[model samples]
Target: MISWLMLAQAIALGAIGAVVAIAGIMRRPFGDWVLGAAALTFLTLVVQVVASIIAPIAGAGPTGDLLEYWTYLITAVVIPPAAVLWALIDKKGEWSTLVVGIGILACAVMVYRMHQIWFVQVA
Candidate 1:
């Protein structure tokens, strides 16, 4: 993956996570803002998915285990939607929001791992 793109994803995810976290801490219910943020975060992961597909073709192939890299990417892509679904189903309000926040934070970490696999780790 491109270095700048990876960094941007991290920052974006971090900011999204923080927002969700604060809302949860403030005892806010799952609302439009949270849903919108989660949707945006998921869209960014979709973008990352596309970038992952195209990056290798552009000769930015990963130097680490391809399986590991793909695993992280897939998990990162899945987290937001899964968390959002859980939030929608559960009526625990802030707790559900917290779950989404945590999930997004986890996705940020996974993205960093993907960066390592793509550009830092040795096969």
Candidate 2:
């Protein structure tokens, strides 16, 4: 993981969390706007995953186990989409937004762990 990319990941997670929180506060459903924000936010994870894979090919891989790092990365990627799917199925209106917000917060923490795991071997 490059230093700048890690910083971007942090900022992305923060923004994602903030967006979700705002949705909940505004009593916004997982409608078009919310889903759009989620897609953009999830793009950050996609970028991270791409960099993770390419860095190894370019001999800039993380110091940690590749399997472990990718595992965390994959899991981080799943969170938002899964929550979105749930929101679509759930009929509880704004309550579904609460679930989405909480899920995004959880992803933020998970992303932090993924960042830490990148240097596990070094530590």
Candidate 3:
């Protein structure tokens, strides 16, 4: 994984998580802003998927266990959409928002972990 891309993902997801959290704290329901943000974050993960495929070909392959890295990456890619669908289906207002917030924050952490596995930990 590219270092800058990893950092960008972390920061963007963290910011989105914070925003969603604040909306939940304010007792807001699942709204367009939240949905839009989640979609945007998911789009970034799609980019990450493409980058992961290309990076190895470009000589930036992960130094850690490929399985672990791919697992984290796959999970990160799945979280946003799943959380959004859960929120929409549950329609529990602030609770739904909070759940999505938690999922986004979790994705941010996973992105950081993926960075570690890619660049910090060596197999």
Candidate 4:
């Protein structure tokens, strides 16, 4: 598990969430460009998750609680797309932007936790 890389990923995700939330707060719709950025962020998250899994299998991953690590990983993997997909389906979706931001924030938190579970041993 690469601490700095994961930290950067988390920060990027958090920043995306902040941007989305700000846009939503400003009464802006979840437009195409924001969606595109969200998609790219999700892709980055996917890559990070894959690399994390492989690292453990390669005997280089975190040695903490496997259950916690996997839970965080699974949650991190699912939330973004699920939220966006649901938002996209709704006809009105007045709150879609905010929900998407919340979802992204959740993913960021999960990724950060996963990084901790993999690299920072709890005392």
Candidate 5:
């Protein structure tokens, strides 16, 4: 994954999360925002996956073993959909909010992992 793109995605996800939190605080229904965020994240992951696949074929520097990268990629792709689905099932007050919060937390963690991967490569 491109470091700049990863960072951009993280920032976007963070913004989405913040919007979710604000909506929750204001007692607004944020299901649409949640879904939108998930869709956007999914799109970003698609780009990351394609880039990762092509990088090796283009004879780029070591990224890591394909299996290891795939593991991270799959997890990144799965989390948002899972969170959105769970949120949809939970109509109870604050549950959806919790889902968004958790999703945001996961995104933050992924961003850190992406950074770590880049750091390892640079070292």
Candidate 6:
């Protein structure tokens, strides 16, 4: 869970979400853009997970509690796949928009979780 990388991903996801939402509102198709963004996000998550595992073994700073970090990591990794699946399953524009909305919300929550991991009083 690199703080900078997490923040960057979250922001990128949020921006993509906004673009999808706007496209939806305008009665335009945004699936291609959504798919591309999701792919990028998934790739970033994969890299982040690998780096997180290697960092601690190489004597980096405290990687935080394993359970807490894994929960966030899993959720972050699952989201893009879930969103893409949902989009694929539904051809309706409304449902596609809903999926984007969910992705945006997930990213927003992840942003808060990232902040907590970085600055909160973890007991």
Per-residue alpha-carbon lDDT of model 6 for 13-117, expressed as tens digits? 677667666766666654677678667767877877787688667765343466676678778888878887877887565667657656765765775575566
What's the candidate order when arranged by decreasing TM-score? 3, 1, 4, 2, 5, 6
**Residue 55, model 3: Cα distance from true site in angstroms:** 0.7
Model 6 clashing-pair count: 0
**Against the hidden true structure, what lDDT does model 5 obtain?**
0.69
Q: Per-residue alpha-carbon lDDT of model 1 for 15-116, expressed as tens digits?
A: 889889887877788888888888888888898889889988998888998899999999888899999999999856549888888888888889988998
Q: For residues 7-122, what per-residue lDDT tens digits would candidate 3 score against the true structure?
A: 99899999989889788877789888888888888998898899999999999898899899999999999999999999999886558888788888898999999999988886
In Å, residue 117's CA in model 6 sits off its true spot by 1.7
Residue-by-residue lDDT tens digits, candidate 5, 1-123: 567877887888787767776676666664666677777777877787787778767776444455555677778778878877777877566668657656765765676575566446443
Q: How close is candidate 3 to the true structure, as a TM-score?
A: 0.95
Model 6, which residues run further than 4 Å from truth?
61-63, 118-120
lDDT of 2 by residue, 17-111 (tens): 77777778888766676676567657878888888778778987677676777887888789889878888888367667766776677776767
Clash count for candidate 4 is 0
Tell me which of candidates 4 and 6 scores higher on lDDT: 4
Cα shift from native, residue 38, model 3 (Å): 0.7
Residue 105 in model 3: lDDT: 89
Residue 65 Cα positional deviation in candidate 5, in Å, after optimal superposition: 5.3
Worst 10 residues of 2 by lDDT: 29-38
- After the best TM-score superposition of candidate 4, give how far the Cα of residue 29 lies from its true spot, in angstroms: 0.9
lDDT by candidate, in order shown: 0.87, 0.74, 0.89, 0.78, 0.69, 0.68
- Among residues 3 or more apart in sequence or in different chains, the pairs in candidate 6 whose N, CA or C atoms overlap within 3 Å are none
The lowest-lDDT stretch of 10 consecutive residues in candidate 3 is: 90-99
Reference-based lDDT, residue 55, model 3: 94
lDDT of 2 at 99: 67
Question: Residue 118: error of model 5 in Å?
Answer: 4.5
